[model samples]
Target: MTRPSNMREWSARARAAGEAQAEPTGATLIRGARVLDPASATDRKLDVLIENEHIAAVGEALAAPARASIIDAHGLWLMPGLVDLCARLREPGATHKASFASEMPAAFAGGITQVLIPPDTQPALDTPAMLIRVQRLARQAGTLDVRMLGALTRELSGAALAELSALKSAGAVGVSNAAAPINDSRIARRALEYAKGLELPVHVFAQDAGLAGNGCAHEGPVATRLGLSAVPVAAEVAALRFWISLVEDTGARVHFCRLSTARGAELIEAALGRGLPVSADVAAHQLHLCDTDVDGFNAQCHVQPPLRTRDDRDALRAAVASGVIGAICSDHQPHEADAKINPFPLTEPGISALETLLPLTLQLVHDGLLSPLQAAERLSRGPAAIAGLDSGRIASGALADLVLVDAEARWTLRPERMLSAGRNTPFAGRTLRGRVRATWRAGRAVFRASG
Candidate 1:
């Protein structure tokens, strides 16, 4: 999947705008890199020219413009910065674990420029003011574009619906209950119907509360042998069935978040076959780990929708490769050391995953399960499309959100070197390939890894 950059030649208007600035306003020339832009199905050695906040031009041997800063990206890979849809930033609530200030850098370091801030903050994103505050905090982190998801239920209590319209006006990209279940069918139906009318997509974490009651690990041989409370795959199946039924009945666009089971993928595929306006994403970790990884009560492997069997992991990978699952996210929930230091069941469930996203995604490529373009699609175009965001492209006139990767570089995930405050990653000490060497947002250098 390689295409010659057919971008128009750089113009005088762009050069004039660049020269008008008192500062250098120099264009950035990234040369000799293998550009993998899935939006255009492009994968080849090329040069990219960035001016102001957009890509000026992209092609082989693109000429260096006046006052341009050249980044010799020989032997590296370049692609659109990932748009992560489920990065739960612990801000305006649990700063002790990780704040927007901390996670934003980790996001950038992982080649993520745009991230969806889930609605489960301390005060929740029920109020426009709370959403505004979270957005503000994220913006202050420099070049990280954060889209806020308004609370689907007031304070995510699953009782009263939040001011979805107000939150929309206040810049919410979507609405979600954020892991909270609306036990009442009438209220849930009304919420979906109302949100559909408002043209807002609903992000749902499908899990039957009762079925998953007190479950800390997936119902499998691993959990049984470990004597852990088991969360059966039925929990996810029942919950997804519930949401898909609503999507079909209400004609509401719904996104299934962090899908964990093979049965869940089958259901999502069937719903899509029926032409329901539905989408799905899996956390990067789920595509790699399974319940077996939880052996020895490794608290770091603990996560909601607890890791399932290897068959389930394989099914998920197949879904992504076949486009049945269109997106993959970090599902980042950074917790303090003490939060995960307790016994497996007592510890908070989540992985400090912002920094592992790119490497793990690239691992799928290395495994030959996906081509480079397919990998880029899952990381960028696919997620951006789900969020209805104007991102995840590397063509002319596209926002200059991009990452330069040392695709051949192998590195160990050392907790001390991580940017996120939470040192609770299961990938810690694991050697991963495809390191993010540098990242840019809106054409400005934001993160450059020290070799």
Candidate 2:
């Protein structure tokens, strides 16, 4: 099958085929790539023929069409491009921190084709126009797909609910308050009820504000010794407990964001056992770093739901493997150089994650904690399911969003080499295995590594 030339024609063809597949500019033959589709439980050496941005066929030693471009992918691994559930592509307000122009390269370099942008910005994404503006910006940039997440509360203040239905109609995939904790349980419950009535998924960052007051690091020996206010693991557990009850009462679907503690995972698992409509994700950094990583007051280690103890980290790793935790995200917040000039306690919390997401994730695979397929699922299929997206699987009649990886390739992290404006990653100077060789969206090569 040939792909359509534009989205309109593509949609028409997709509707007729009962699938949403992008139309490529021409037929593309990817030969001898190890194709892995976690959603379909497929892992094998195969040849994939993409026509009009949709996969036309997959088999061994498939012959290429006469005019199709051939990409010799021997020894490389091909899979669906990643779908990120949480990331702050600072735009509309904090362009200096990060923007579409800067973040897209990082996203593409990391093999992420679609990223869900959070509502935390100067003018919160609370209105249909705001949501549309971000979409327009992404389209203008002409790179990866950027999905908008509208604010659950007006202005993300958590004081009042936003126009949920209108935001959805404006193309918001889901709603969230970002990291702004809703102190009023009543307002939170009402928001969930409204979302339930409209059948929208609500993404919540669980944290009890009062309990997490002025905290700059995890509440443990590290914070105690550093003389900084700490956010205890109990803060997350408390907020999750309250939110779980509301989810049960209102029957609203919820996705708990950045689950960092052992007890927190236990709460979500118990909720799932009872069949409450819920899912959860952990930050990739949380799985790899802990309170110990914050020693010497390394400002980059500061993150919301501040990295917990090693016990918590081990538990989170176990939860992800056991299927209790569905996804892993970069939580990719890019900060300007001066953002960390202040004292460690005063510096902002985040790590520049886009460039390092894949390599760091593959570390788990190297350690025997997660297989390549399992890790890819957390990065692609799992997050896509959480956001109700359509781009995280590869198959006939599906979107041609894919990435090719040199799974055993090694690279060193250097801030100057990163595409993002933020140079705040904790992994600088570290050697990481596995690197993206190329990435495609709708069968067009959007990013290709230089030799």
Candidate 3:
């Protein structure tokens, strides 16, 4: 089904044109900026020219066209816009928590231009009609490029396999049962085989439901001290081991989502050693914050597959640094405030991430855990590769999806100032370095830092 182009009411074409007029004109030259092109493996000072939503040139001193805007990017780092592999922009069902309209702006504010939303929603994106509906809603929102993931099982129930071919035909980039794991290995193997035949990547949330068993926090000293039921590392490890065995048996491409345990990383590392076509992502929160953050009965830190020990967090950071982890996603699950107002265990799991992904990632750089180029790779190139999207690069003929950041700028997290409807972030009031100064998607400036 063709989406209605007129439904996009939030376009910034007119406003962007006005802003363009106020700036110097000449092929939108981004001057004196350090360019980081992970795809091209070029990290140096260069001027990039954008024309008609495509990168025209990149060099030390590129000439701009007579009628184009010139942006001064001195002391700024210019790189490809981030491609978030996992994010939940609740539109069809839970708009009160988040919508494409709200999430897109938040994504832009954090330097993201493309996002792959999971299938966990009201009607669920398991059918062609539902996938088309998501596409239409994304078009109407019109801020960032959105791709949908088809649910791996019907209604994400893990009982029956979804129509993989039909969902892919309807524009699902991949298939997943987000936030819910397939408890039965037989069922999981069947789903993997079906996805293998379709040559579609299957995204698995590696957690054994039986092991997780109504747990609300990570199983550790923190959970014990807080008097909360815990989700053990075995839940994640056992599921990963089963999935890895299935991958070897079926030759299916698998992408693990939000790997939170040290054992999870070890399993992935061993799989890579054996040459399996598998990749995994670590959420920014999991990489930085740990289960200890859940102290004092603060439900905001609650998460699915729950946060783990400091050692686990360190292991994830090391995995990213060692190249075992391919991508770093926001896993941007937004929940309404009231949903989180209850006591610890009953509160919803997830935290608002679209707005904080970039700043939090920059914190990794500040701590010397990740180089600037590695951070760019995890945030952009890697995620783009996982979704088969033609983005996350700065090259001739590449789409003009770019972000310019002031690496030294500092700011504090403010939930009320966020664009996402959900105000359930744990980063609230935390000061951080680095800031997204401007974001351009398809030659359009979707966001600019406030003065």
Best-matching candidate per lDDT: 1
Worst 10 residues of 2 by lDDT: 14-23
Please tell me which model should have the higher lDDT, number 1 or number 3: 1
By how many angstroms RMSD does model 1 differ from the true structure? 8.3
Off by over 4 Å in 2: 1-24
Instruction: Give lDDT per model, in order.
Output: 0.87, 0.86, 0.85
Please write out the lDDT profile of model 1 over residues 224-314, one tens digit for every residue: 8999999999999999999899888999999999999999999999999999999999999999999989999999999998999999999
Q: Which stretches of candidate 3 lie over 4 Å from their true place?
A: 1-26
* TM-score list, all predictions: 0.93, 0.93, 0.94
Prediction 1 global C-alpha lDDT: 0.87
List the RMSD of every prediction in angstroms.
Answer: 8.3, 7.1, 4.6
Report the C-alpha lDDT of model 2 over 427-450, residue by residue, as the tens digit: 999999999988888777777787
lDDT of 3 by residue, 1-451 (tens): 1211221322243223224422222258899899988898888999999887788998987877886788899899998999999889877887656667656767888899999999988998889999888898787656578988999999998899999999999999999998776767788899999999998999988988889999999887888888899899999998899899999999999999889989999999999999999999998989878887899888899888798999999999999988899899998988766888899988988988988888888888899998899889999999999888878899988988999999999888877776666678999999989999988888777778878
* Backbone clash tally (model 2): 4
Candidate 1 vs. true structure, TM-score = 0.93
Which runs in model 1 stand beyond 4 Å of their true positions?
1-25
Worst 10 residues of 1 by lDDT: 1-10
